[model samples]
Target: MTKTLLIGGNSAIACALKKNSDREFISLSRSEGSLDLDGDLNELDSIADIDGLVYFPGTINLKPFAMLKEDDFVNDFSVNVLGAVKVLKKVINQLKEADGASVVFISSVAANLGLPYHASISAAKSALEGMSKALAAEYAAAKVCFNVVAPSLTNTPLAGNLLKTERQVEGNEERNPMKQIGSPEQVATTIDFLLNAHKNWITGQVFPVDGGMSNLK
Candidate 1:
C-alpha cells in the first residue's frame, strides 16, 4: 500500500479522507501548537518516505475587500503556502526515494472567478494554483506529479456558514447545477484518482471540482 501524508487532517474533508483512504497515512496538525515546521516535521519519523502528500489547511474568512484585515492575508499565506513549502522541503528526498510520487494542493474556485467578498481567498488560492503548475513542471523530470484541486463552495467544516441554517444549506444546494451541495467524500475521490498511477501522465492541472458551479453559472 502507498504511504501518504495528510496535513491538517482534522478538518471535515480531512476527516473523510482519513476514514476512507486504505493507504498508510500520517496525520499532522498544529492544533496543540506542536507542529512547528521549522524545527521538526514529527516527534518521531515513523515512515521514511511518502508516496502521496495532500495539504489541507485553508481559511473561510469571507469579507468584502474593505473589511479584510491585513493579518487576514498573512494568516492565509502562512497556512496555505508556507506550511506546504516547509513540508515539501522536508519530504522531497523521501518522495524521490519512493521513485515516483504525487503532491496535491487544495485550491478554491474563487481563484479563477470573481465573487462578492472573495478577494482575499481568491488572491491566495490563485497564487497557490500558479505555484502548483510551476512545481508540476519542475518535478515531472523526477517522475513526481503535482496538481491542484480547485473546488467551489463545498459543504465542509470550512464552509460552515453555508450549512449553518437549514435555509442556507438548501439555498446553496439549489445554487449549484447539481441541485446539491458538494461533499468532502466527493472531493476526496478526485484526490485519490489523481494520486494513483493511472494519473501518472497527468500534472500541472487545476481541476475544478465544483459540481459545475464554476462553469455552469
Candidate 2:
C-alpha cells in the first residue's frame, strides 16, 4: 500500500480523501496532539518512506482592508504558507526516497479571484501556489511531484463563520458560475488525482476545484 502523510489530517477534506482512497494515510493534527504549525516539527523524524503528502493546514481570516492588521496577515501566512514549508522540509527526503512521490498543498480561489475580505488569505495562498510551482521544478529530476489544489468557499468547519446563515450560503452560491458551493468530496477527488504520482505526467500545476469561480463570469 502507498503511504501518504496528511498534515492536519483531521480536516474535512483530508478525512474525505482518506475515506475515498485505498492509500494508507498517516495524520498529524494539532487538535489530536502536539503538532504546532508555528513550532518545531520533530515528529516527522520517525516516519519512513512516504509515497505522497498532503498539507491541509489553512485559515479563513476575513476582514475589511481597514480592519485588517499586520498580525492578521502574519497569522494567516503562518498557517497557510509557513506551515507547508516547514512540513515539506521535514518530509522531502522521505518523498524523494520513494522514487515516485507526490505532494499536494491546499490553496484557495481567493488567491486569484479578487474577493472582498480575502486579502490576507489570498496573499498567503498566492505565495503557496508560487512555492508549489517552484518546488515542482526543483524536484522534477528526483521524480518527486508537487502540486496545489485551490478550492473556493466550502462548507467546512474552517469556513463556518462565512456560511453560518442561509442568506450567507445563498449569496455565496449565487456568486459562483455553477450556482453552488463546493463540497469536501469534490475537492478531495482532485487532490486524490494529484496524489497518484507515477500514474500521471502532470506537475507544476494549480488545479482549481472552485466550481469555475476563479475563471468564469
Candidate 3:
C-alpha cells in the first residue's frame, strides 16, 4: 500500500483529496489529526515509510504593499516555505524508502502574476516554487521528485472571506478568463496526479490550476 503524509488536514484541498484518494493517508494538523511535531522536525522520525507527501499549510494575507509590514512577509514565508522545508527534511529518509517518491507543494497564481493586494503571499510562494525546483534537481538521483501546484482564488474555507459577498465573488470571477472561480476538487485532482507514481517523469514543474488567471489576463 502506498503511504502518503498530508500536512494541514483541515484544508479544503486536503479534505477533498482524502475523500477521493485510494492510497493510505496519514494526516497531520494542529487542531486535528496526529503526527504532532510541535515545531520539532525530529518528531517526524517516528513516522513510517512514506511514498508521497503533500504540504498544505499556507496563508492568504491580502493587503496593499504599502500597508503590509515586515512581519506579514515573515509570517507568510514561515508557513509557506519554512514549514514545508521542515516537513520534507524530516520525512525525506522515509520517502527515499519507496521505489518512487513524490512531493507536492501548494502555491498561488499570484506567484507568477502581478496582482494587487497579494504582495506578501506572492513573494512567499515564489520562494516556495524556487525551493521546490532546487530540491527536485538535488534529489533527482534519489528518485524523490518535487513539484508545485499554483491555483487562483478558489471556493475554500481558507478563501471564504474573499468570496463572502456576491459582489466580491463576481469581481474575482470576472478577473479570470474563465469567468468562474475554481473549486478545491479541481485543484485536488491535479495534486492527486502529481502524487501518483504514474507521473514519475514529471518533476520540478509548476502547474497552474488557476482558471486561466495567471496567463490569459
Candidate 4:
C-alpha cells in the first residue's frame, strides 16, 4: 500500500480522506502529538519514503481590515505558508524517492475571491498558492507534483464561528452559487485525486472545490 503522510490529519477533511481511501495514511496533528506548526518539525525527519503528502493545517482569522494587526498576517502566514514549507523541506527527498509522489495543500476560496474580513487569510493562502506552483516547477524533474484544493465556507470546526447561528448559516449558503455549504468529503475527494500523482500528469494547479464561489456569480 502507498504510505501518505497527513499533516494536521486530525482535521475533519483529513480524517474523512483517511477513512474513505484505500491508501495507507499516517497522520500528525497538534491534538495528538508535538506537531506544532510554529515549532520544531524534527519529528518528521524520522519518516521514511512516502507516496504522497497532504497539508491540512490552516487558519480562519477573519476580521475587519482596520482591526487586523501585523501579527494577524504573520500568524496566518506562519500556519498556512511557512509551516507547509517546513514540512515539505523535511520530506521532499522522501517524496522524490517515491519518484512519482504528490503534495496536496488545503487552500481557501478567499485566496482568490475578494471577500470581506478575509484580508489576512486571503493574503496568506494566496502566497501559499504561489509557493505551490513554484515548488511544482522546481520538482517536476523529480516527478513530485504539487497541487492545491481550495474550498469555500466548508462545514468544519475551523469554521464554527462563521456558522454559529442559523442566520449566519443561511446567509453563507445563499451567497454560494450552489446555495449550500461544502462538506469535508467534497474537498477530500479533490485532494485524494491529486494525491495519485503517479497515475496523473497534473501539477502546479489550484483546484477550487468552492461551489463556484471563486469564479461564478
Candidate 5:
C-alpha cells in the first residue's frame, strides 16, 4: 500500500527500481510521465499518496576544465542538483504529510574522487551528496530521511558514450576491485534498500555503491 514517486524513471536505475521495489511505484520523468525540469512540477500532484521519493536525473557532461563552458556547468548544476531541489521543494508537503518518508538521490563516484573531463558533473554531484546529508540531518526530526548513492561506472544510457568503446569499457571494468562495472539493477537494489522500512534508522549518509571504485585501486 506504500506509494512511491520516482522523479526520473526513463533511466535504467529507475526502471530497475520499478521492477525490484515492492511498493507502489509512480514513475515521473521528462520523457514519459512528467519531467518539466525548468517548468512547474504540478504534475507530481497525482502522486499525493506517495510515501517515498527518488530523484534520478543526472548530467554526464565530462569535459576537461579548460574546455568546459559556462553553459555546461549551468546545465549540469540545474539537472544534477537544482532540479532535484525544485521538485522536492514542490512536493515537500506530500512527504511531510506522509510522515517518515524517505528521499533518495543518485550520485556518481566522481562526486568525491577526481577524474579528467568530469569537472562540471563532478562538482554538481558533490553538491547533491552534500545537500542530501544536510537535509537528512535537518529533516530527521520530521521523520524524513534523505540519502545519496554514489555509484561507479554503470551500464546505463546516461553513460552510453563512455561505455561504447571497447577499451573504455574494459578499462573502467578493471578500475574497480570487483573487476566489473555496476549494473542498474544492482544499484536499484541498493536504492530499494535505502528507501524501504529496512533503513528506518539510517540517514544523513552517502552510500558508495561503487564497485570499490572510490576505495580500491
Candidate 6:
C-alpha cells in the first residue's frame, strides 16, 4: 500500500485527493479534526515510511504592490514557503526511507506569469519553486523526488472571494485560454499522477495545471 502524507487536510484539492485515493492517507493540518502539524513536529517522527507527500497549505494575498505591506509578504511566505520547509524537514528521513518517494508542492501560475494583484503570493510561490528544485537535486541520490504543480484559479474555498459571483467567475474564465475556471478535481488528478509509482522518473519539474493562463495570451 502507498503511504501518503498530506498537509492542509481541509483544502479542497486535498479533500478531493483523499476522497478518490485508495492509498493510506495521513493528514496534517490546523483543522480541529485533523492531526495538527503546528502542534507537534515529533508526531511526524513516528511515521515509519512515507512514499508520497503533498503540501497543500497555501495563501492568496492579492493586492496592488503599492498597497501590499511587509507583513503581507511575510505572512504569505510563512504559510506557503516556511510551512512546507518545516514539514519536509520533519519527514525527510521517512521520505528517504522509501525506495523512491515523491514530494509534490502546490504552487500557482502567478509565480511564473505576471499577474495583477498577486505580488505577495507570486513572490512566495516563486521562492517555493526554487526551493523545490534545489531540494530535488540534493535528494536525487536518496531517490527522493521533489516537484511542483502550478495551478491557476481553481474552484475552491480558498478562492471563494475571487469567484463569489457569476460575473467574477465568467471574468476569470474568459481570461483563461480554455475559457473555463479550473476545478479542484482537475488539479487533484495531476497531483495524484505525480504521487503515483509510474512517475518515479519524473523529478524537479514544475507542471502548470492552469488553463493556459501562464502561457497563452
Q: Which stretches of candidate 2 lie over 4 Å from their true place?
A: 32-35, 38-40
TM-score, every prediction = 0.91, 0.95, 0.93, 0.95, 0.93, 0.94
Query: Residue 91 of candidate 1: its Cα lDDT?
Result: 84
lDDT over C-alpha atoms for residue 46 of model 4: 70
Question: For candidate 6, what is the lDDT?
Answer: 0.87
Comparing 1 and 2 on TM-score, the stronger one: 2
Residue-level lDDT tens digits of model 4 in 1-217: 5589999988999988988888888887865223265454676677676879999989999999999999889888888898888888888888888859999998899998898899999999999999999999999989999999999999999899999999999999999999999999999998999998657999999999999998899
lDDT of each: 0.80, 0.87, 0.86, 0.88, 0.83, 0.87
Regions more than 4 Å wrong, model 1: 32-36, 39-46, 197-199
For all predictions, the C-alpha RMSD in Å is 2.2, 2.0, 2.6, 2.0, 2.2, 2.3
Reference-based lDDT, residue 203, model 6: 86
- lDDT score for residue 31 of model 3: 44
Q: Ranking by lDDT, best first?
A: 4, 2, 6, 3, 5, 1
lDDT of candidate 2? Answer: 0.87
Clashes of 4: 0
Name every residue pair that clashes in candidate 3: none
Model 6 RMSD vs true structure: 2.3
What pairs collide in candidate 6? none
- Candidate 6 wrong stretches, greater than 4 Å: 31-36, 197-199
Error in Å for residue 184 of model 1: 1.0
Q: Report the C-alpha displacement of residue 37, candidate 5, in angstroms.
A: 2.5
What range of 10 consecutive residues in model 5 has the weakest lDDT sum?
31-40
Give per-residue lDDT, candidate 1, residue 185: 90
